[model samples]
Target: MPHDQLPTQAHAFLRQRHNELGIPGLARRWREVRAQIRANGTWRPTYDELAYAARVAWRNSGRCIGRLRWPSLIVRDRRHITTLHDVGRELAAHLDEATNGGRIRSVITVLAPATNAGPPPVRIISPQLARYAAWPSREGVLGDPANLALTRLATDLGWSGPTRRGPFDLLPWIAATADGVLHLLPTDPMHILEVPIQHPNHPWITDLGLRWPAVPVISNMTLTFGGLWFPAPFSGTFMASEIATRNLADEHRYHQLPAIITGLRLDDRDRLRTDKALLTLHEAVLYSFEAAGVSITDHHRESRAFARFAQHEEAADRVVVGDWSWLNSYPMTPQDPSWSRYYHPGQPTPALLRDPYCLALTAGHPKPGHEPSPRQRADVPPGRCRHTQPRKGGHVSTRTPVKAHRRLTRLAAAAVTLAAVTAGLVGVSGGPAQAAGCRAAPYSAKFGAADYFMQYDGVEVISYPKYPSYYRTTSQCRDIQVRNTGDGVDFGPFYACVNFYGRSGCNYWTYVPVGQWRNLATNVKDGTKFYVWVRIDMGKYYGFRAVGDW
Candidate 1:
């Protein structure tokens, strides 16, 4: 790679670390690295630096809620993997150690960076080593809808499936090597941990036949450090809701809720039914994982962890860039302190960046010439195939905004819980509810199911509605709010919006600061009323309007 291709500060970062950490190999490598930088302006990091970079990426992951454990990340140096088969072998070991027979550990295996300044020589097409197969059948599709395209890629790569396919069938690993040779490796059943879900309170849920892999090992992410890109596969234990709400109950996936709704005899017509089902389903995941002695974290526990992380970062004067929606996606999002505030997502630094091959496969595009495309890649499906096709594959499949909706519903439910709790609640013994003089209610209410709000004694909570994920859409329009004291006096439009759907909206207050005794309400006290106006618009796609008087 040319010297300019390397980040301008790459050498500086390495040199500073050399002087600070004083690691043995770094000084000698630093001399060689600088020589290469002078000759070609690009250099490779030593083994120790690679390990440091991997850990830094974990520490800087904004979308991940479990970042507090970044220090415990285990980085395995596998940069010498020269064969595609070896990639699979290492990945299997990754799964084995990551799962750790249910005592999961966060781990990453870093492969050699792209050499000769070319695209990655080896790439894993699968998002994770273990994912359910989405098989096409006369009756209907089986397994996770997310993996439909990759499933076809595996089959075409000479992978034979069981005669009787079930929803839990794991897909084989697919990779492309330096010589552009593609290899398919069947997933080892023993290396994968699939936990059957059973509700502690509702044992009948076991009959629903639900199970999910224990660890989420993400491959196909390019780990860039000191201006070099390493194909690193990393693993982390699943948040219970990631399995319950997304992999299982998502509309395009197992669509588990309809059955649960029927089993619980709840009315599906009402949107609240979905919320109830999600809560119960998530509960089952936590309970079952615990019963089976599998590692898992609930949303609340993770939120608390995030709070501590934020505080620690703040103490060090570090800016905590966060995707509010993602961080607040737990079943009880609104009640969490993290959701009540706003954050700036500065940048994705030292993080596990998405790979083109991974996105292509995710978009239903298989590797070119690796295997016959199940659906020819020529006819790209809008919305489904975000990237161009690698080879032939079936028609592009549509992914529902279920993942985004999952986050949205969580925030919405939290808002409802907040309102109920704020209105006043009795003690555990069922005494009469009591409240202080002040009352807080949701403001600028529109986008019914998407709107979220919370109010504590002195502070008010408001969340601008946002889209599901940036993967499917990019239009992030502004939301407006205004307040007035009856007459001509008014506070003009205050605007807020989120750039990416996967992120949270900017902050805006409909009312002004309260400390001034010459307040508008106090000044115009005689027979005067206060009014506030709020509007939300999404570029003519969706609009909401509301006005309130007090």
Candidate 2:
């Protein structure tokens, strides 16, 4: 049946899509939506939720449906998979009856490690395939290729995330709808479901949410695993005007072709005749299909695509890493090291950890290719080494010559202690006590008051206990120290560091080893006397400020 004969709910859903596409005459239908939302006073399935979802789904799908108007193929949509039973059954028959039968293609994207890093997981499946894979479907729903792809992708990403989560979960990005967009809750033992969502009157929830909770990472949030919500706004806003102009182009004749395609390899002079997209981000998919005669319009902008107009063909499939542990393969420096000044430029991505955990060491254990870790001897004096011949202690002797560069690594680890303060306070005590000229003195009441850490010229004894000595360079930091004393609060895996090199990079900087966020602030004692550096969490920025008597 046509859109007019559909029920109010289906009609509302259709109108929303129309409004999003800037389809002519859509406003008349949207009036109905505005009235419905107003009458309800609040949305269980609110307009805000619906609109936002549709918007993002569009972007996620590479704006194929979001930007273009397919005038050729007939488009029919139903709110729930059950609503499209006839179409589902028809599509089902085609898949089964077709010769050289091949299962539909699909994939999943999941967040792993399993937490405390990066954004949430994402899973998507085409509409037709979703129905065949979900509950109450008539076919072999359990082993559908699309479902397997989704599961494989999740497994590859190290998701190990709880399964069968749903509609009211925290990660709206992965919530399930009756529609086929993307749903992967299996009724079998392949995956277990987990959720971070709560009911309004749930025993765990308070009226204000904050009143009953001080931490909300998993306890108070909602999570919808194995399901996805379709969104249209992200793509529309990112490509709105560009698409509008294309739709008006004389050649396309009112089709909302993607704007980024003009520079593509496909010729827009004839799309109906070509059956292709101008410049799809689907580079990996296009090339694979191309071998089978599936050509695309995205000839130029599909940088991800291997096949160019020049005839470059990509491998069969673009590999998405199946493991999350690899993300932790790099060293995360929580502070500066004795070998060099600071971390290499952008040593770590924000996907790593909190900024306070600056200059961190991921996996804590090194695999062959992994970067070495920063030392962890904070209380040790600057430019000094405590050499105790270990008869046989579990704590490895970092000073052993057999260890090669381990001593330098130790001092680098201590360098981190200079900036690991919980409060945004940095103390600077510029005297022989903190620096000892070319050496570091142990913690003392008098010297402790001046928190500034130190590095000197000639021979420099790094702060690590087993770290014997390190030479310095000209205009190199003659000596530096944390600007404060006694605020050595240990925050477990959370710490920050500074190199006193300047607000950002300077001549004395080193490869931050592994850490994210550029130093947002730096000071030179009096802003002119000597430069001071700082590392901090982005949420709580603590610029380099002199606290003690400089």
Best by lDDT, which number? 1
- What TM-score does structure 2 among the candidates reach? 0.20
As for candidate 1, its clashing pairs are: 3-41, 373-392, 374-394, 375-393, 375-394, 376-393, 377-392, 377-393
Local distance difference test values of all predictions, in order: 0.55, 0.23
Off by over 4 Å in 1: 7-9, 15-30, 37-42, 268-271, 365-550
Q: How accurate is candidate 2 locally (lDDT)?
A: 0.23
For residues 281-351, could you state the per-residue lDDT of candidate 2 as single tens digits? 22222332333332222312221221121121113221211111111111212231221211111211001
Per-residue CA lDDT of model 1 for 305-418, tens digit only, reads 888888887886677766554566545446776666555544434557656434433333112232211122232223221111112232111122345333432222112111
TM-score of 1: 0.64
* Strongest candidate by TM-score: 1
Candidates in order, TM-scores: namely 0.64, 0.20
The C-alpha local distance difference test score for the whole of candidate 1 amounts to 0.55
